[model samples]
Target: MNWRLIGACTLAFASVQFSPALGQTDIQSQRVQFARGASSATVKGTIKGYAIRDYVVGARAGQTMTVKLTTPNTANYFNVTPAGSDTAIFVGSTSGNSFRGTLPVSGDYTIRVYLMRSAARRNETANYALAIGVTGRPAAVAPKPSVDAVVPGTQFHAVTSIPCKAAPGQPTRQCKAGVIRSPGGEATVRITLPGGSERNIYFNNGNASSSDARTPKFSVTRDGDTSIVTVGAGERYEIPDMLVTGG
Candidate 1:
């Protein structure tokens, strides 16, 4: 993570309306081009004081998009907005220098890079490199696993038990794993079963004293040292380093 200090520029602001159907605006913005499949573009540009540079690209819902910014000075940040909407879908600032996620809607997405509002008053100018990439098919939901299976020769220490539902026509069971907590308010756990693949489980709030019925359940198995985890379709989990081992 890069801590880029940004201040707003002093340029006069303009009110612009975007067409919802085309997701386009009359405002001057740079159009970015990419080849089919996985592609990336790096644009070198400067943001004058109180001014913003907008870059637009087309994307489909479910595709993964990543954007990164490198600035000559710390006074720049970037935002990503979905087509036809003024609200930013993603924002990268001093706390983070990049953004990555699956787009929720298909259309033209805009990436705007500029100085912070405070810096705008001074008309600060900074050079920056903005890199953007979009790839992969539209995200699809994953089917539920048939049964809770454990891989052979793999062992996981019990962390806590949580309620989980089985696939349709399958039996339900209480899930358990070897869990590790993160400072960022999440937990990573490893689970194993006999003759099944290894899996890692991620959830919010590892500090739960007891399992909540609302917590989404995942199935896991083990394959030697690797854990194979499966979740419901359209679900996502952040993968973190395993810090603990279960017996």
Candidate 2:
């Protein structure tokens, strides 16, 4: 008479034992390779349920590494962990969607993409694209000559300095200074003030210019043999020769 109730209880016990929530599944990581002299790589995938994906890449120290993540789901993020360490080197949620900085150690790094804990429990799906770029170490640079000690026969070129009017109600004034040089060799521009402060900017392409939002505002532009520089308010500058020679 109790056979039907006993059978129901046995079926319920078997279902609990074979349930997916009560067991763990091992997920394997994928390896990523970069081409020679290549600075960037991208990985794309979809994440569903409690599954996670990982990518491993090798990098060198002193290299500038940058990462960017694009995803439709806000609850999906990634983690970057250095070799032999459990602590994440970079976490997407805490550090934002992009990371840019110099790497300290040379080794394989892991990039893990997964959903947030709540999202994982709900078995949500997320599609994402991850991009990484590594800029190799810069070439070895020779030290510059001392500022006080001048090299013999090194002539100083005269530059035209134009006073720049400050904005209305502004206290300090600025200037647009110009220097003429021969169109060859690497161009080095040095700005020296009366208080012994100096700022050096180098142009490898021989003729180039750059400007940023930093203040005191400054910019450099090279056209043929003439180099024009814009300096901040009330600062003096020294424009040396286009050719910089030293050990």
Candidate 3:
């Protein structure tokens, strides 16, 4: 188990006296080993809370990669990122749980699996089976999806930004984040930090928690229509009910 902290003071915040260690998630990585005369492999694992699992496989730049994730929990999704880059080529949360794409500049591609903040905060567990395959010769050109077409796995009901402070001692600014809600009104808030990493916060049954690996220590303050979330000692976020609940 190779465990690495996601990042410290993320969510585009720079810490002063107190660090934003809300969802300090730890990543557990495993390398995929293919049998002789085989190009595909299947692995099974279980994750609870804010734990993350990553599967790494080596492939040439032009090889095709196919990944399918089967899990009972709707909150569990995967992401594909090329080696040496933080930007994900495929985000399963938005693109669906299956990915078939041609590799670009790949040495080792990582497929990361995680639970949505809403479920992770409740100490939920997700058991999943991941099937990964690499095959096909390098093609002259990769297939591209048509623009303006309604793509599959587009999960957001609404997308917007909220007022936030970048860090302690910083002025209030509009920090963009993504919100997705289940039919039961539980919402997960995802914020992309600098360098493409993401921080997620969950609002479930009127309780709030972040996806950081560490146990969360924070406070919330209500003002008018906005609820201010303060993480650690000083990092603060102003979340409006309309943005979260469609009120």
- Which candidate model has the greater lDDT, 2 or 3? 3
Candidate 3 lDDT over residue span 167-222, tens digit each: 57877766656444544545555555434444455665434544331335667778
Against the reference, the lDDT scores of all candidates come to 0.49, 0.49, 0.63
lDDT of 1 at 116: 67
Stronger candidate by lDDT (1 vs 3) = 3
Each model's TM-score, in the order given?
0.47, 0.46, 0.48
Residue 131 displacement (Å), model 1: 0.6
Name the runs in model 1 displaced over 4 angstroms: 1-27, 36-38, 140-247
lDDT of 1 by residue, 1-247 (tens): 1112111221111112221211222235999997555488888888766667889988764467899999876768887876534546466653366888655444688988777655665666888889999876542221111122212111111233333333344444444344433334443343333233223444443322111113355544554433344465322222222322221
> TM-score ranking from best to worst?
3, 1, 2
Tell me the lDDT of model 3 at 121.
Answer: 82
Q: What value does the lDDT take at residue 143 in candidate 1?
A: 14
Return the number of clashes found in candidate 2: 0
Order the candidates by lDDT, highest first. 3, 1, 2
Q: Pick the candidate with the highest lDDT.
A: 3
Clash-forming residue pairs, model 3: 23-211, 23-212, 24-212, 24-213, 25-213
Over 4 Å off in model 2, which ranges?
1-26, 138-247
